[model samples]
Target: MTGVNFQFTRGKRNKANRTRSPATERVLTQLKMISQRRKQPKLLQVCQEDHIRHETITTAFKLYRQEINANRAKLLLKQYESIKYAMEDLEQINSYLFHEANTNQKGKRFDLEMRIPTEYPPNQIWLHDYTPAEVAEKK
Candidate 1:
């Protein structure tokens, strides 16, 4: 039987596609403030004095804003992590593909080429003599 990579997500759908963003914190803070203001009409009055719109001062608006912020934060965090991993992969490929060649002459040069995951093992093998473990350790 094949291995199951299924994840049981109860609260949030498509959570794996999401990332946390810096703005999420700010949105959550605003939602907190909105809930607090709802409990105290005096604070809401103060917001009105500050020229905050009535639509923004509502509980419904607060809920929508909170949801939007959460999604934004998730996307941002995901993007950041993806970029980070991509850079790491690039570094890995570079280290494996390019290296200083050893030469006996006063001046000598050599070329190196690499292809990633060319074929499945045991039929597929890396072009060079170095083992995968050795190449990884070198980097």
Candidate 2:
């Protein structure tokens, strides 16, 4: 028996794809503000070993960002290689079609709607399959 990769999901996902954006900047800015305020009197003295903790946090954030960058790069590279291989196969089958595809796909931006599934796959994986107009017409 094959293992089931099934899970329930609601497909109304947002296009919140981050492109070269660092979460660390916002956090560091707040940290900087806190540090600046340290000069004045404070209500609570919770920040013990402030410099060391700051360094650790900064380092961890940088490392995490690098890891995310590397993973993204790897996924992109895999996608690129797959596309290249597909083009090669298409060229082998039909050169004209391959040329048309290669030439026409010049200024196409990557669609953010096609997201990598983190948990379970989206309920409506492909938008092209279901048409409300068709359903209306049928009824």
Candidate 3:
């Protein structure tokens, strides 16, 4: 017969269902019992299964490293912003103090040092850009 026209025929099969070996059946029965009793499988229980422990450990390590790097990035950004604000304040003070000076008859010049009070008395900081009371009430 040509390859295209060839047909396969079935032979007589074994009458018995190929039974699982006794040890395999016992293990399967134990697994079923454990699964029935426990709602959640413990990580240690799953790790005992072959080849899964390495994958789980590696994934956990990577997640922890990512969290550490993210926290470090946030801390560095906060430090940068703090330094930037301090520099801005220093620039403002320098401009106010040294931009103009007065010369006396002996040509001795004195640049006035404008003192920004170190103490923040109550309500010293400007409070602008707050949402209007009426708008806040509507929200």
Candidate 4:
């Protein structure tokens, strides 16, 4: 007596062609769960950091305005204004940095170490070594 062997490949191909199958559903569900658990926390962190940086920059601007108003010397006023404008620019840069950091991207932090020029013929100032965190806390 000889035994007959039977194998089926057609069913496998048919299953592959079918949509809304159990395997596909399971895979999609797993992917969605993973994404929700991971990406959301990061986004939240970014948002918080952005808010903190914004508040800091705002404070810096207020202080700069006060300083500008207090000075009576003509040359000092001009220098104060230049520093103020440069600091405003620095604030914008910090916003960009915070955004970049939240996105897990690298960016230059604000530099407070550099002297903001007080007297120049063109009224220009250079900002260096400042980070968004530092710029925000600056008075």
Best by lDDT: 2
Number of the top-ranking candidate, with TM-score as the measure? 2
Model 2 weakest lDDT span, ten residues long = 12-21
TM-score of each: 0.28, 0.42, 0.33, 0.20
Give the 10-residue window scoring lowest on summed lDDT in candidate 1.
96-105
Query: Could you give me the TM-score of model 4 versus the true structure?
Result: 0.20
- Compose the digit string of candidate 2's lDDT tens values, residues 1-139: 4775544555653345322236855687688888784367656555669867988999999999999999999999999999999999999999999888868655465555657768887787667854454365688
RMSD of each candidate relative to the true structure:
25.3, 24.7, 24.8, 22.2
User: Candidates sorted by lDDT, descending order?
Assistant: 2, 4, 3, 1
Positional deviation of residue 79's Cα in model 3 after best superposition, in angstroms: 0.4
Clashing residue pairs in all predictions, respectively, total: 4, 0, 0, 7
Question: Between which residue pairs do clashes occur in model 4?
Answer: 109-130, 110-129, 110-130, 110-131, 111-128, 111-129, 111-130
Per-residue lDDT of 1-139 in model 3, one digit per residue for the tens? 4544433546643335324567877899899898885469566544455557778889999999999999999999999999778767766778553333222345333322333556665453544655655566699
* Global Cα lDDT for candidate 1: 0.61
Q: What residue pairs clash in candidate 1, if any at all?
A: 19-74, 19-78, 20-73, 21-73
Against the true structure, candidate 1 reaches a TM-score of 0.28
Give Cα distance to truth, residue 37, candidate 1, Å.
26
Model 3: lDDT to the true structure: 0.65
Give one digit per residue, the lDDT tens place, for model 4 in 1-139: 3575444444554555555668887899899888874445444445878999989999999999888777656778799999778767766779775455446535554455444565554333444643566466675
Q: Which residue pairs show collisions in model 3?
A: none
Stretches of candidate 1 above 4 Å error? 1-57, 95-139
